[model samples]
Target: MSKNNKISALSEKDGVNKPEILSSQVAKHIQAFRKKEILATELIEKIIAGDKVALSRAITLIESTNNNHLEKANAVINGCLPFANKSVRIGITGVPGVGKSTFIEAFGKHLTGLGKKVAVLAIDPSSTLSHGSILGDKTRMEELVKDENAFIRPSASGESLGGVARKTREAIILCEACGFDTIIIETVGVGQSETAVHSMVDFFLLLKIAGAGDELQGIKRGIMEMADAVVINKADGDNIQKAKMAKVEFNRALHFFPPKSSGWQPKVTTCSAVTTDGIAAVYDLILEYISHTTTSGYFDAKREEQNQYWMLETINEQLKNSFYNHPEIIKQLELVKQQVLNHEISPFSGAQLLLEAFKKKT
Candidate 1:
């Protein structure tokens, strides 16, 4: 049969009248308009309106690994940038048994009672085997979990240094833009991660338990030096005396170090999260520090420095990602590794070869 005859017969069989391209295009446009793809502008508006669901969705976008979502995340952040950096960022670290979650529950409730909104960006330790969060912070922070003014997000740090999640700084910006006045970043109590957390926050807190050896608390002198405040938890019951002694020791240890760049001395305080005793005092100390630093212009300067540090860190991370993810590098990476193992090429030379290959491809 002729092609035109076949087409006409098939079109008639399908009950076709005019199968028009213009009609299909109009339908496509209507569908596109009806589909309602989420926009960066709409998300930003919902976030600024203090909608928690929108806030959570924005964080999820920021944490997403999909390249397509990366642009949207950046857009959300860029949109929110003007509203960010207005809040206090506090980094909290402690050994596993020091009741960190309990303390956070008490602290968050206390802050909300004062009409402050609190957001906790907690880094939970992931299993080396399964790579899942070991501690469920929401279950642990029972009271704060029920508070409308409190937001708790647990990020599993899978094989990351010091159990600090990769996207925590970005999460902080999201929370702040959504109008949370206080952001508490809770890191898994490994000593190495304190530097990572400290670099991102305005104040770094070291939470310690009484009667625990330096080894027990996993706190090194260097970590101690990084702390803006050393708060000894579990200060009630029969442990009060020991807590006091620990405070003195911490104060003495802090005295031996040179003063911080801000010239603000690190303080040692005792608190009982269970009893809520001295909890207010701990926050008072924080307020006092903020007041002194703000009056001295150190608070603003410190935050500005943090922003610069994060920018450089982000650049480094992106360079490493691009280097490893380039097609040319991926193809040769295994061969380069084998050569290094066989001593056929020096490690530095192998690295240079791969880097040159990547550069050429780019």
Candidate 2:
């Protein structure tokens, strides 16, 4: 058959259809399982049926930038809200050579051995600049990656703040929905701004190296203020004493910062990701933080605050997109830029004019 005939035949088989509804009401209904309007058992069955394509599609729905997808995503999150609180969210960050992947591999193995399921979502900042990610963490975490109780997802950060990916927060929700007890977000440990990860996770951990003296350069007040615990990697072998020294420095530094949301002092420890020494201590510290916060009601409060923050962020993102998509605003933006460049007005004035034009249109 000719190409036109083939297309016609397929179109006839499918019948005529209207453009898709941006709000995706059908998707919202599918996500209503969390409200008891749908069955949780059936949801779990769908997730665990080894349907890789379905899982990927579900993740895309949750990560979507479209306003309609946002509503559907919220419905899905609400449905899983009750079952989601059981998991512990931990944020782990460190410099390039601090062995974050190795530590997570060993730590995850330890957790699974204790009959717990672990989920690791690592965000590689380099992916944004290079448009490629090493994704080496999965290879380094060979054992954990293969374990049935473990799920490792390496995502491209793509210009996101704090070397954290955009969909990480949503991915955490999905992992909780799937019944994972531990969710670990690994971020590229650049410096101060990395605290964005702290806002999302329950426990915020900072990984350091022994005697990197670069600690003085990277350990700003902002990072220390958010950290719940600081771990010095490569503590085994000859690096042990140096790691101990680094831990002391970090401990002293922590004294100047205020307490974290959990109202507990962030502890400092040294560990060898290679030998897995002190990994259990790190896990123990996380549990202690969780216990303290939960008992004090801070855990619930923090989650509430996080939700509010997410809502505000969503609103800002949507407004920015809407402004750029507005035809009148786009036309005025070019004129405004030209005006500014010709020194006819300051950039701020040009922006004001654009805003005025936009408001008039709406």
RMSD of each: 10.8, 10.0
Candidate 1 has what TM-score? 0.87
Across 140-174, the per-residue lDDT of candidate 1 in tens digits comes to 99899889999999888876677888788888888
**TM-score of each prediction:** 0.87, 0.80
Task: Using lDDT, give the best candidate's number.
Answer: 1
Query: How much lDDT does candidate 1 score?
Result: 0.88
Q: Write the per-residue lDDT of candidate 2 for residues 74-180, one digit (tens) a residue.
A: 66666655656678999988778888899899999999999998889888765545667676778889999899888887877766675677777777877776777
Candidate 2 has an lDDT of: 0.78
User: Where does model 2 exceed 4 Å of error?
Assistant: 1-45, 48-53, 66-72, 126-134, 215-220
